[model samples]
Target: MSRDTGTDTAGMTFLESTPKKMLNAYLPLGAFLFVLLFPFYWMAITAFKPDNELLSRDGNPFWINSPTLAHVKKLLFDTAYPEWMWNTVVVSVTATFFSLAASVLAAYAIERLRFSGAKQVGLAIFLAYLVPPSILFIPLASVVFQLGLFDTRLALILTYPTFLIPFCTWLLMGYFRSIPFELEECALIDGATRWQILTKIVLPLAVPGLISAGIFAFTLSWNEFIYALTFVSSSEIKTLPVGVVTELVEGDVYHWGSLMAGALFGSLPVAFIYSFFVEYYVSGMTGSVKE
Candidate 1:
């Protein structure tokens, strides 16, 4: 009888301790997930809800009634969403490719070459990134105007590189520094040119950093509002951020549902790209920081 009582007390104690331990382990994780996901959840829900339901005072925060596809349809058919989307794609893809190309070459030169003032040049490039776009845009506007690219996609594609290349060059330089030079030395001894070594060996090793730089450049162009807004004035030439905010919002009559829908859709491409290459993205970002 005493033995049975002891076993019962031990089992009860184990059960109580197990839950406490599990809670301690998972509570922070659960809270973090909720905080990260709640805004996305709200946006998705609000996108589906009808205008009347969205504006309802008695509507539940966590649940919506009378869901409709009107906002999605309007965004797709009744607005310039498609044009804006295409413009964003063009600008982002063009800017990203150019930025990556420039960054890779610049980073390779800075990392491999033992020239005078190389370190200072690299630092100056990074400091260029620190300069406020507000101050630079005025000067850039004159350059774009002189180049006959005003109110055109060329204006954005050309101007985006000025900002992207500097930071991206700095990022790739750090990443390239982390790579050992022994591999390149051997390739050089085997009659490989600098261009050949970069194309065949260094580039393959730096794929993660390249992808990271490309992703950063793409996201920067995609989300850039100030430059896009300041440079492009025509409705047909506007990119997503400026187009969505200015064209979608009618004075004080805000279309929250449609606006949220546009934002959600605009973010989908980037989200998909990031999700697919998340491992490389993480490695690249962390590796650059470490170097």
Candidate 2:
């Protein structure tokens, strides 16, 4: 066998040029970065910008000449922003916990229980996630009202699991399927109960999958709008997304500074979490791809 050393050397030479690298790699990345980050940049600048600069067309819209803490102060003091943040945290954490617990059980059962029609059952669960929340919200509204859970954190916490459990279960099923069956069989031979195997053996190895599912579930619950709007009516119980949009903007007037401030602050936690778990997230996603 002959190696195509000339072709390889030519390809490497082409990539070695700074201009070629800039055109092929940096340019596209620059565009994508600009598009992805512009909104956040705008939001950050708008939060600190004085009203004159924000509204007036006389100066630079991209940078603030004089930054002010007014928006942050106003957002924290004038509205139920703090309450909204607390409510979002509570609902997201509670719902994510319930959904993950249920998903782990369902995923393990489907992947490990050796049940009849297991593949079909797993497909059905994933398909359930495809159904739009908009259509489900109307019917869920009736159920919420009948159960007297309307306008409360309990309403959001419980209803969130409907959408959350299906996706989490599907994600976790892929992860669980990747585990070697021989390991599970070994556990069984050692007289470990199914629950013990799940809690001790499977869960320990599936940490990345759990983190991915949790991050997704928590983010969904945090930014959820329709269910938050439908189930919650009170300012105190409203989550960050709903509270920021509804309370910050009066019918005809928009508090641009405060609105941007609320958005900026509201997004920080999610960003922080993504930065922290991004490795596990990528691993969990690619883990299923390999299986």
Candidate 3:
């Protein structure tokens, strides 16, 4: 009877301690989630608030008095927003695809082939990435003008690949090295050509790394301001960053509402891409570590 009572107390204590352990485990995660999400939440709330309410100092900080679609409508309708968005999309997609294609081939060559000066070439390309775009853009601008591609989306597409491909190649080289060579040997024995093996086996296996590199390239091109501002002087060819800043502010007067809306809208696609491919992004970032 005393033994039964002791067991009952012990079980109750264990159950109580379980909740405490669970809380301890979840507390840090909860805090981190709040920290990361709070700014986005604030931006979203501000985006919905009426201009008057947004400008008001006495109103609720977290909640808006009046929510309206005026800002969103103005951003979409009253500006070169569509053209800017299209330019960004075109440049980002083209740059990402070209960068990935070039990087994969370069990486595969470096990892699989024993060519003279291949190592030196890879090192040179990696070093190129360290040169700031600020410096490169000046010389590149002259070249673009000489090539008659200035103030054109084509110029941006052409220039972005120079920076993107090298870094992506180096990243993928590390990842490719991590893949077991025995797999390639077996594929070769099975009568698979180099192209067939790369397309069927190597590429499929390197999807995560490819996705990471592609995302990096896409985001870099999409958010780039200096190049877009320098190279694309025409409003028609301007991307979101340059277009939004240039159009939304008319000297001393600022279009805060539309600016905020554009920022939020511009960021949405990137956020979606990251969310959907989160696992791949994580794997790609970590999987390249060569032991």
Candidate 4:
């Protein structure tokens, strides 16, 4: 009985010695979740809240007294929002596709070709990615004007690759490096051409990496403001980021409800994509390359 009693006391002491899970885990997690989700919650509420409630201070600021779809209706019917959505999708997808194709070729050549000054070329590409879009837009604007591509979706598609290619190349270089070289050697021994090896073996194995790069490029293109603002002047050709801010406001007056609605709606597609492929994104970033 005494031995059992001692054992129970020891177990109780061990339990007491353990760090507090509430403080170490749940508290931090809860706080992080609140911080992360608070903006979305605010945007959602603002999107739904009637203009009277949005401007009024009589009720709880966080809670919507009455919800209406008037703002969404205005955004959809009264503005060129649908066109902006279409433009955004077209530009983002096209840009991401071209960027990924170029990145795959560039990354593969840099990592596998073993050519002279390969490391220098890779480093230079990454350095180009580090260049600010704010600076590049000035020169890019000149080129866009010269090419007569200004205010066209084709302009965005072509220009987005300038930044997208470098970053995607850098990301894919790391992923490609993680892949075993033995596989390529074996393919070469089996009389497979470099093209066949890349298409059948390397690319198939690098789907996670490709998806990660695609997501990044797509998100960047989707949210791109400076180039979109600078290049596209017409409402019909403007992207979501540029169109929402430009068309929604008239001089000093701000349409908070419509603005929030536009932002919330515009953000949903990217959020959906990210959530859907988050696991692949994680693996790609972590370079889980298998033999």
Worst 10 residues of 3 by lDDT: 1-10
Best by TM-score: 2
* Candidate 1 global lDDT: 0.84
* Predicted candidate 1 versus true structure: per-residue lDDT over 68-150, tens digit per residue: 88999999988899999999999999998988898888888887874788888888887787777888898899898999999
Could you give candidate 2's per-residue lDDT for residues 1-291 as a string of tens digits? 013233456445564689988988889999999999999999999999988888999866888899999999999898999999999999999999999999999999999996899889888887787888999999999999999999999999999998899878988988788789999899999999999999999999888789988988888888899999988999999999999988899887788999999999999999998899876656545543443
Q: How do the candidates rank by lDDT, highest first? A: 2, 4, 1, 3
> Model 3, clash count?
0
**TM-score of model number 3:** 0.84
Report the candidate with higher lDDT, 3 versus 4.
Answer: 4
Candidate 4 residue pairs in backbone clash? none
Better of 2 and 4 by lDDT: 2
lDDT of 3 by residue, 1-291 (tens): 013333455334454576686686568789999999887887688778887887778857789777888989988888889989999999999988988898899888877874788889878877886778998888888999999999999999989988888778888887787789999999999999999988998889887688888877787888888888888898889999899888888788676777778888988988888898776655544533322
Ranking by TM-score: 2, 4, 1, 3
What are the per-residue Cα lDDT tens digits for candidate 4 across 1-291? 013333455334335434686676678999999999999999999999999998887979899877899999999999999999999999999999999999999999999986899989987997897799999899999999999999899999999998889878888888788789999999999999999988999999888788888887788899999999999999999999899988998788788999999999999998999899876556544442321
Q: Between the candidate structures 1 and 2, which one is better when assessed by TM-score?
A: 2
Over 4 Å off, model 2: 1-16, 283-291
lDDT of 2: 0.88
